[model samples]
Target: MSTVVYLDRISKAYEKKIAVKDLSLQIDSGVMFGLLGPNGAGKTSSIRMMIGITMPDSGTVNLFGQPFTRESLKRVGYLPEERGLYKKMKVMDQLVFMGELRGLDPAVAGRRAHDWCERLQILDAVQKKTEELSKGMQQKIQFIATLLHDPELIIMDEPFSGLDPVNATLLQDTLIDLKKAGKAILFSTHRMDQVEKLCDAICLINGGQAVLAGGMREIKSRYERNRVLLNFEGDNSFLQHPAIADYKDYGGQAEIQLKPHANAQDLLREAVQKATIYKFELVEPSLEEIFIRTVGEKVDA
Candidate 1:
């Protein structure tokens, strides 16, 4: 339950533009935290500061409950969205080098490199040059490099990028296993739905500021569950009811977002009269919906 990474009142600006403004967030041991934002929202900038890739103009970064320093980074694993590998180097050699850079000895680094490739099902590619491997395989290599030194805090930016479903799921399971092992994990990704299922807490940034931040359940609870999902095979006249704010009808299915202070039970009664309801359920706003709503509102303002 100890804090693993903390950023207090961090601010970063590039020339005339601000990248992060008074941003603050914390991650605790055994927790998976999501850093979310639309393009140019400062998620990447904030993450860079967390790992000391760039210093914030003003603010503090504490890693592993201590003041930020290069030594602390040895206990922190980072995989940036932009992957780097020696094109001419063999997969195993490249991995070993990356491991050593993170403080492993040559023998230990090579051993861990081979072990990870086998566990990740990429052992065959060990002898091949990094340039010859597919993007997905190279990504797996980078993932191994991140864990080479057995870091306690893992930070990944777009970890699932360019991966097939099977490989993506493989990485997801690995991250979950790490969390169970008491490592604090932070990830920034555009895949909101996946984050919704995987992250325990989230900080949503817009225009370099955190517009929403909290435990997932607490944040979702603040929003009204006035959305209705209807599965019917007949007339869809209920979608036009006065209580319905907006709706999307796809043949036998309809997704309805109710107006403010709208009564869903009243709308359901009307829906039953027009269509033979096969399934009717009211559900909370998904993370995706909330992301759009919050970011859209910020943009409009």
Candidate 2:
């Protein structure tokens, strides 16, 4: 099926507090869909419902073209933000156990676990017990366990948590490769820059409701690029142009914010004539900017 995960007007609440309200989105194979929001924005609740960990108070969830079921979970792999490895168990054994629980044969599970460890650069720690490994190492072990059975729909919540830059990059590259191999991935993280770099589509949830959802290009295209980056060696008189709303000058560099319906081309023309322009280009609103503007609050990310 083209759609891997579908949430149709789903809502969830606790006691008298609303967690999520009428949230909806879709994930398709071969794309890393980012689930984004500020803290307590209903991301965790939505995910719990999506994976059958909790039922939604209203609406429906579909997985792999069918209604979500306990059995359907076998086709999905999840690595939650909370680590749950058995501290006493050897890393290799833990991964194999998780794989078997997902219905993989023991031998196959062991083989796949070994390969994943090597790929994740954690093979040397295979025989070590979970407690002996560093947090980063244990995190990699958990990552390996999540993928050991080779699931079709992969859900990683804060996957980069507790990982070093080098290891985080390794996991990111591996996820990209899995996406290329037709695995549907849903990434939930606070890192907007990483989301912008890794995801083609995104859903920004605030107060458990989807404030924005669409392909990255389509969503970004909807916002006007009113910010400009200019590097010049001469007079910065262009910063005072009528089109300019405000500006920040840093020596030869400047960040100019334009007024609504202002013409960037008009400002560029003025800048070129007034200074020896080294770099003159309009900068699009970053995902972080879009997030803050949409929710009207600063995201913890």
Candidate 3:
């Protein structure tokens, strides 16, 4: 795949504080890439530099095989983390205005905005003032605006915020559709479950740098500890099976850590023999766990 966006040695700072330092990454075309981190980990700063909202103090941002330029804005859609919408303006009007800002003509923008409103299931709210809509509705509206111009790259920050499950699923489906249409997407979010479900690749940012980055499957495989989760209904004493060396109880299930060469199936066999096993499966570390392990507990300034 071709590189859609590339950041080479990118660095950003505000006054005496560094936001991003020596950050480098290449986003492949047509992949749903996630930028994940804690609140002040520079995810937003890195995204800002990519979209030309802020220039890097040092380093290069290349968009679509060329230096980042004003023209590239036309091919990119940005849904910022900080929500911004004209309070008094109608939903349709706001979307149209945003499309125009993306260089689309009024007629085309209006047409596309209408289509987007319908697709997002918010056509009925088109005439309502931005402030009149519920938080989830407003989020959907902004999401529509981001894609109104039909850009090739969609960059989003906290795209799931203020959204209910139904609406969030709608947005997720829409993203999948966009991916099928060959759009490259970069999103920053704290919703690890959503990231695990949606992203093809991810970059874990920490302390102004990437602590971990790679394809979802590859990263998970690399972090696999050959652990197993088990649930049994019979005697609880069976959990004391000698085969399991490390265990952490999580509700009804136990996260059992197997020995270095201990076969997962062997452990399961022992577990079943000792108790009536209700559930037993090998598991991979969650993204949250990986993030904490890789980034550590030190808070960045």
Candidate 4:
């Protein structure tokens, strides 16, 4: 796959604060890359630099494998966190207008807008004024607008912010399909669960620097599968086994955290002897657990 976006040691700062520091990552075609962080973790700052909304103080930004240029931006589509729709305009008109700004002919823009609205199950809202729609509907409109011109690189910041579960899942499926069609998608979100499910690779930022970055499986592999979930019918005394570090018991079930390099097999053997073990499974650290461990704080998500 071709590299769609590249940031080489990019750094940016305001008068006194560094917004991003020596951050670097690349997104390749047909890949879904998540730029994750807490609020004010420089995710937005890094995105702005990627799309030329703001210039970096040091290092380079490359698009489609060449130096950044206005021409390159035509191949990019950006959906910012904040909504920017013209509230009075009809949905179709607004989407067509956005497509035109991206160099699509008016007729082609109108056609694509209608097709996308139909595909997204929002055809009935095409003639509705933007301000008349609900927040989720408006968000979907913005999403459609972002893709109307068929850009190769799609950047979305908190794209699922106001969406309901069903709509969010719809958009998620859409993004997966886009990735399959060879679009390079870069989304910044606080939703680790969503990232774990959708992203092929990720760059997690904290305090203006990457705290964890890699393919999902590779990153998860770095941490131990020291957590265990148990279900039993009898004695809960086995929870005190030497291999266990800490655990929470809820009557017949327990969620356990093992001590570093603890032997899970020993704990399982003990658990079985004390109780009729219905289930005993050792699990890897979840993405959220790794995030908190790396960032040293709970995620707002």
Candidate 5:
């Protein structure tokens, strides 16, 4: 796939504080790229620079293989972390207006907005004022507005915020379909589980710099599968095995963290000897674990 967005050593600052520092990453068509970071870690700064909402103090921003320009932004759709909507306007009207601002015909915009609302299960709210809708419903409206113009690149900041499980799944499946249709999607969210599920590649930032960047599988493969889940009855003395650094025992089930470079086989052998093992499996470190390991802090998500 062709590169849809590219940032070359981008840097940004406000007053004495550096918001983003020498960050470089690229997004390709049909790929879902996760721009992940802790709060105030420059994720918004980098995204703002990408769509010309703000400019980087150093390095370059490229969209569609060329220098950034306002004209090129027409092909980009951005849904910021802070929601913006005309509260008094009807939901459908607000969506159509947004579509028109992006160069869509008024009629085409209306039709698209209707179809989107139906697909997202918000058709009933289309005639209601934006102010009358629930936060989750309003979020879905903004999501529809983002895609109304059929932009080639979609950037969403906390797109799933305020969404219920059912609504969140609806949007997730929509994004998957969009990616299959060749749209390049870049989203920044605190939801590591969602990122792990949706993103093909990711750039993890901390302190305004990239701490980790690469394809999801490649990055995960770099970390050892040192976690173990065991379910057994009888004696639980295996939890004291030397190979295990720590573990939580819940009577018949245990979640274990193996010591660095420790042999999991040794732990398993010990467990079998002490208890009747029903299950023993070595699991890869989850994305959240990797995040805490790299960032040295637990994610609030």
Candidate 6:
């Protein structure tokens, strides 16, 4: 796939502090990409550069295979982490105004805004002032504004905040639909679970640098610990065997890590002989666990 967004040796710094340091990334077309990191890790600064909100102090940003320019901004939709709406304006009117800013005709914007409000199950709030609606409804309204312009690339920062489970799922489904339509989407968030579910690729940053970046499955497989979780219907004394490098008992089940030199078959054979092993399968680390391990190790050292 062709690159939709590319950052080459991008560096952004304040007067006395470096916010992002020599970061480079390539985001491809028709994929959902995630930019993840802890607070103050420069995820926001990097994204700001991508969308032209701020320029990199050095290096280049390319959007949609061209040099970043004012015209390119029309093809992009941005939902910032700090959401704002015209509190006194009716929901539909505000959405239409936002769409117009993105180059849509006023009539077209109004029609699209109404359609989106209905589709998002907030038709009743069409005429209500934005401040009159609940926070979740306002969030949906902002999301509608983001889509009403029909941009090719949608950039969302913390899209799930202030949303209930049902609404969050609704937004997830909407994003999936957009992906199916071949729109390149990038969202920055701290919610690892959502990233695990929705993103095709991810770039994890720490202290202003990209620490991990790749296809989710590929990244997890690379970090595999070669361990298995097992549950048996008998005594758990076999977990103490020397063949198990790391073992922990959790209620009726045990998580076992075999030594790199030891054969997994030997351990399974011993466990089967001693107990009726019910669950036995290699386990991959969760994104949260991987994040903790990756960053924690650096901090500890």
lDDT of each: 0.93, 0.91, 0.87, 0.93, 0.94, 0.88
Please write out the lDDT profile of model 6 over residues 1-301, one tens digit for every residue: 6788999989999998898988988887789999988899899999999988899999999998999998998888899999989999998788888888888899999999888888889998898998899999999999998888888889999999999999999999999999888889999999999999999998888878888888988999877465788988887777877788888888678878777656677778888888998888876767877788777775577
- The 10 consecutive residues of candidate 2 with the worst lDDT sum are 292-301
Superposed Cα RMSD, model 2: 2.7
Question: Which pairs of residues collide in candidate 1?
Answer: none
lDDT of 3 by residue, 1-301 (tens): 7889999999999999999999998887789999999889999999999988899999999999999999988889899989999999998888889888888899999999998888889889999999899999999988988898888889999999999999999999999989888899999999999999999999998878888888999999887566777887665665566667778876567888766666777667666776777788888878877777677744432
Clashing residue pairs found in predicted model 5: none
Backbone clashes counted, model 3: 0
Give residue 290's error in model 3 in angstroms: 1.2
lDDT of 4 by residue, 108-197 (tens): 999999999988899999999999999999999999999988999999999999999999999999999999999999999889899999
Q: How many residue pairs clash in each candidate at the backbone level?
A: 0, 0, 0, 0, 0, 0
Flag the better candidate by TM-score, 3 or 5.
5
- Candidate 5 error regions (>4 Å): 297-301
Candidate 1, 21-75: lDDT as tens digits? 9999999999999999999999999999998889999999999888899999879
Clashing pairs in 4: none
Q: Which stretches of candidate 1 lie over 4 Å from their true place?
A: none
The candidate maximizing lDDT is: 5
Ranking by TM-score: 1, 5, 4, 3, 2, 6
